[model samples]
Target: MTWLITGGAGYIGAHVARAMTGAGERVVALDDLSTGVPERLPDEIPLITGSTMDADLVKQVFAEHGVTGVVHLAARKQVAESVAQPTRYYRENVGGLATLLEGACEAGIERFVFSSSAAVYGNPDVDLITEDTPCAPVNPYGETKLAGEWLVRAAGQAHGMATVCLRYFNVAGAAAPLLSDTGVFNIVPMVFDRLTRNEAPRIFGDDYPTPDGTCVRDYIHVADLAEAHLAAARRLTRGGAAGDLTVNIGRGEGVSVRELITVIGEVTGDGRAPVVEERRSGDAPRAVASAARAAEVLGWRARRGVREMVESAWQGWQLHHGK
Candidate 1:
């Protein structure tokens, strides 16, 4: 079955596309190229450069590619940007999903896999988060993801489509240097940026209730995260589950900001200390995941550790920056 991968030129999307294609799956990449690098995709893969908001274009791609399944990863994902520009986030993320669903349903696509985020949980007070956690998103980005999940499920049920929503935590690392995450918004890249500049990395807060007084997060390698997408796609293809399957993709361990910085120093041999800054508003102290459901449902588990994340990401960073 040919699958339409929205945002397939992006970092995570590129990895997913590479894995899917390597597995002998028929893949078509649909990216707007706003932040996506076309070179990240293979030479043979056909990439349709456009926006998912354009319903006509989306439908046309579906028909032209003979797409029977879809993996929707196109959306504005920056938390800060979404916080500042809620309207744009809502329009692009939520509106884009609605338009794509319309196209998928119209094309009678049998399978759909949505790229969701752990941001939907906001600041869960639990030690280990599960799929059943109450979704009270604190920011516009999270709100859009949660809302998008609803849209995917509803559309799938209405149209009799198999669907899966993969909720990702802090994603880091790369399968290859060329495929490393290029954005500085994430903490891993942020730390790498500071080290490369010979400047001290700044921690957002140090007065939280955690043992280290810093935010604790679950980090999953981008390679592992991409593999999870492939697994979810296979499940959809097999039609093992009748309804929607929502699962968290993570390493199930909490790494404090302090600890993460220390690991980065070790990985890069830049033992410079980090500067503690004031806590950013809406920062969650801890948001570790319980990956049991993902393992049970998709038979997928993250294989890389934080150190691997740092080293692999460092290789890409050095390559990209000539460092």
Candidate 2:
């Protein structure tokens, strides 16, 4: 079955596309190239340039490619930007999702995998967040993701589509240097950017109520996250009853920010101490995933560790930045 991967040229999307294709799944990519690099995708996979907001394009791709399933990853994602432009986030993330769902339902596509975020849980006080954790997004970006999940589930129930929402934790590392994330919005790349500039990596806050007095997060290698998507897609394709499944894609391990910086230092050989700063608004003290649901549902677990993530991400940073 041919699957349509929206934002297939992006960092995460490209990884997902590659993982799916490597598993011998027929796939096509749709990306707007806003922040996505076309070269990240392989030469063989067909890459369509358009917006999910375009209903005609969505319908055309679905019909022409005979797409039986969809891995929807195309959306605006940036906490600061989303906060600055809430309307744009709603329009692009939520509105685009609505349009795609409409087209998928019309086209009779039964399988869908949505790219969700751990941000939907906001700063929950839980030590290990589960799928059942209450969602209280602190920013518009998270709000959009949560709303997107709702739309996907509602559409699935109404249209008899088997759907999975994979709520991602901190995604780092790469399958390869070329497939590495080019954006610095994430912590790994952000730290890499600072180190390359000979600047001390800035820690947002160091007085959180954690063991190290810093925020703790669960980091998963991008490749593992991609593989999780494949597992979800395959489960849907196996012809189970139409239903909704939401699971966290994480390592089920917590790494404090300070600990991560130390790992980066060890990997990059730059031991410049990080500068502690005021806590960023809405910063969660700790947000680790239980990962039990994913293991039970998808039979998947992260294979790589934090050191591997930093090492792989550092390689990508050097490849792109020539550091």
Candidate 3:
């Protein structure tokens, strides 16, 4: 079955496209090219330039490509930006999703896979966050994702479509150098950027309750995350019951900021000590995933470790930045 991957030329989107097509799945990509590099996608996989907010364009792509399933990955993801511009986030993330679902239901599309985030859980005080964990998003970006999930489930129930929401946690690394994330929004890249400038990396908080007084997170490799998407897509394509399946995509392991930075220093051979700063607001002391549901439901697990993530990400940074 041919699947339409929204945001298919972006960093994570490109990885998903490569993994799906490598597994012999027919896939097409739709990207606005705002932050997406069209050259990242294979020439065989058609890259349609448009937005999901455009109902006419969404419908046109669905009909013209004969798309039987959809893997929606297009959305604004910056937490600080979302907080600053809540309306824009709602319009683009939630409103755009509503439009896409309408087109999917109207087209009789039955399979859908949503790209969700662990941010929906906020700063839960649990050791390992499970699928049933309470969602109390501290930022507007997370709020939009939670709302999008609700809309997806509601649309699925009404239209008899199988849907899955994968809440990703701290996505890092790259499947290839070219596919590596160029933006410095994430922690790994943020640290890389500072090091590239011959400056010390800054740790947000060193007074938290966690070991080393830093935030702890579960980092998953981009390639493994892509495989999880393929697994979710295949599960839907196999004709499962018409319902919603939500799971967290993580390694079920926790790595503190200090530990990760030390590994980064080892990888980059620039062991400059990180400067400690005041804890950022809305920072979670720990946000590790249980990862049991993903393994049981999708039969997928993360094979790469923290060192691999840093090494691969550093390689990608050097490739793109000439560092």
Give lDDT per model, in order: 0.94, 0.94, 0.95
State the displacement of the C-alpha of residue 213, model 3, in Å, after optimal TM-score superposition: 1.2
Q: Per model, how many backbone clashes are there? A: 0, 0, 0
Question: Which 10 consecutive positions of candidate 1 have the poorest summed lDDT?
Answer: 234-243
RMSD to true structure for each model, in Å: 0.9, 0.8, 0.7
lDDT of 2 by residue, 1-323 (tens): 99999999999999999999999999999999998899988898999999999999999999999999999999999999999999999999999999999999999999999999999999888889999999999999999999999999999999999999999999999989988888889899999999899999999988889898999999999999999999999988886653799999999999999999999999999989999999988898989999999988888999999999999988888999877
Q: How far is candidate 2 from the true structure (C-alpha RMSD, Å)?
A: 0.8
lDDT of 3: 0.95
Residue ranges of candidate 2 with Cα displaced over 4 Å: none
Once fitted onto the true fold, the runs of candidate 3 whose alpha carbons sit more than 4 angstroms away are: none
- Report model 3's TM-score to 2 decimal places: 0.99
Cα error of candidate 3 at position 136, Å? 0.6
User: In angstroms, how far off is 5's CA in candidate 3?
Assistant: 0.2
Q: Candidate 1, residues 1-323: lDDT per residue as tens digits?
A: 99899999999999999999998899999999999999899898999999999999999999988999999999999988998999999999999999999999999999999999999998989999999999999999999999999999999899999999999999999999999888898998898888888899999999999999999999999999989999999988888554799999999999999999999999889989999999998988999999999999899999999999999999999988755
- Comparing 1 and 2 by lDDT, which wins? 2
Model 1 segments more than 4 A misplaced: none
Give the candidates in order of lDDT, highest first: 3, 2, 1
> What is residue 157's positional error in candidate 2, in angstroms?
0.6
| Candidate 3 lDDT over residue span 180-241, tens digit each | 99999999999999999999999998988998899999999999999999999988877756
Pairs of residues at least 3 apart in sequence or in different chains that clash in candidate 3: none
